[model samples]
Target: MNKNIVLKAENINKYFRVPTLFHVLKDISFEIEKGEFVSIMGKSGCGKSTLLYILSTMDTDYNGALFLDGEDLSHKSADQLAFIRNQHIGFIFQFHYLLQEFTVLENVMLPAKKLGIKSLEEIEHDAIEKLRLLGIADQAKKLSMRISGGQKQRVAIARALINKPSIIMGDEPTGNLDSKNSEIVFSILKELSEEEKLSLLVVTHDIDFAKKTNRIIEMEDGRIIS
Candidate 1:
């Protein structure tokens, strides 16, 4: 409930019913404060990604209380959750989910367009600024498919920043990149957290990546082990 806390998850638990019921997460409780860069590390199937989804408001079939920017998310309708996600949370995945046919600027503008709080010209200008912030403004006029993998991911990051979400959530954001590209992305994210006062919660298997974050939450068997 602290004003400085950007996200808080309390007594979170999850289960999957297919092929018999299976417990996926257990009593996960944590808080991320403004401008803090945090990483979650664990083996596959340890529920790090699953937890991210729940925290991101993409998955609602779980028992827990999730708070973002002081608003409780439990029991919210799908549409309400969608608006919350669009307005308060930005997400990046292991893969850049850019539309191949769209130009980089268009891709970055999509989320802000959905929010519909700004005019077209304003959105375009904001998108360009985000691209410039990521050092990819020159690529904005090109189709997403024409860019390199690293460039595409930077476009994704730009897209995620378009709305100035209170927190950015990434699930193995650098998983598909080479070391050079990965380091570039990491530095970009780190700078955003420190300089822009943006909160970041990243789920990564890369030990080196986890080590560089402000804090690391290690998971085992669906529980935070450290």
Candidate 2:
């Protein structure tokens, strides 16, 4: 396993046989290094999410060799992949996706709890710290539905980071936000990547935000373009 290259995918292909067969993703290849922020930009329906899903090991019924930290994950079963993903990767989606019924603190602690961290107090303390880092500590006791969208998304980021994953993947993270909120969201993303040495793969349509990453990969027709 290469210490620097956190993820690398070669010749990835995916298809769906629903309402007829659809070849959603063609052969694709890319590599992402540790602490590197890469933006995946493309038009709508261009298979960017398919690629992200594959990289994150969320969608595994595909053809490719996906290496994470120098280990090939293409052969791992769904359950095994889930374990690695919960510990090593975080995901932020366009929707905040925080459980509306749970308090921010509880939501953030969910992943750690699932990982069998027996010390609930310590885990809650850690979740509180992540909320503080995202400047939403005050909302920790509040339900996700009661907060602003931006705040909710911040909570989502905190939840994603609570496990201290080495990599964070965002799928159009700010697509649902207005300009100011989008800036705030991406700024947090940029800062977190630097401070935590996290490998970030953000899929976005915003050119300005996309260009801020260390590398920007443009996609067309399910293929990465230089």
Candidate 3:
């Protein structure tokens, strides 16, 4: 499905100014086909995270066009970008970012609620199924702060999939875990990408994990090196 182009980054460029100046992305471009698991590997300052942020719409001031299903993303306003993110993209980060105060079930439900998805029972049902798939359903009602790091990461994965996103982007998702746990997390991500036909883009410094992805992209000095 490479020809389908589920996502496209056309000559993308991003610059950060003030305090100091930096060209974070240098005419970078890439695409993720539907159901592909792609990994971006780079040194810490090579802009892999920055690229993911821009692609995920977490940062929108870049200089090129991003298309989702062939729709120009640069034309959208901040509110519209937020709405699109809510509707089609789910983000997972190294830090799990679960609200420590919220229960696992609550954390997963927050995004759906924010998007005004109706039928609370139905949403809960879906969320519960995700948690079950990730092996955390038994802890769904427990506070996130009380879970183990691996368990917390599982919660984060479940949260990311709760919306059934068309694309899920993760940055160093397994960076904080031990080898055993990292493999667990990657397997879950791999399962979801295949089982749900979701395009997954992950950035990682772990070469072993990166190599396991369907496509391994190497970056250096803000450019794709391989």
TM per prediction = 0.98, 0.95, 0.95
- Compared with the true structure, all predictions reach lDDT values of 0.95, 0.89, 0.88
Candidate 1 ranges with C-alpha deviation above 4 Å: none
Runs in model 3 lying further than 4 Å from the true structure: 1-3
* Candidate 2: worst-modelled 10 consecutive residues by lDDT: 114-123
Clashing pairs in 1: none
Return the lDDT, model 1, position 220. Answer: 96
Q: State the lDDT of candidate 2 residue by residue for 1-226, as single tens digits.
A: 5689888888999898889988888888888888899999999988998888888998888987988888889999889999999988898999987888999899999999998754999899999999999999999898888999999889989989988887899998999999999999989988987877889999999998998888999888877777
Report the C-alpha lDDT of model 3 over 34-141, residue by residue, as the tens digit. 899999988889998888988888798889989887778987999999988987888888999999999999999888888887688888998899999998899998
| TM match of model 1 to true structure | 0.98
Error of 2 at 159 (Å): 0.6
RMSD of each: 0.7, 1.4, 1.6
Question: What's model 2's overall lDDT?
Answer: 0.89
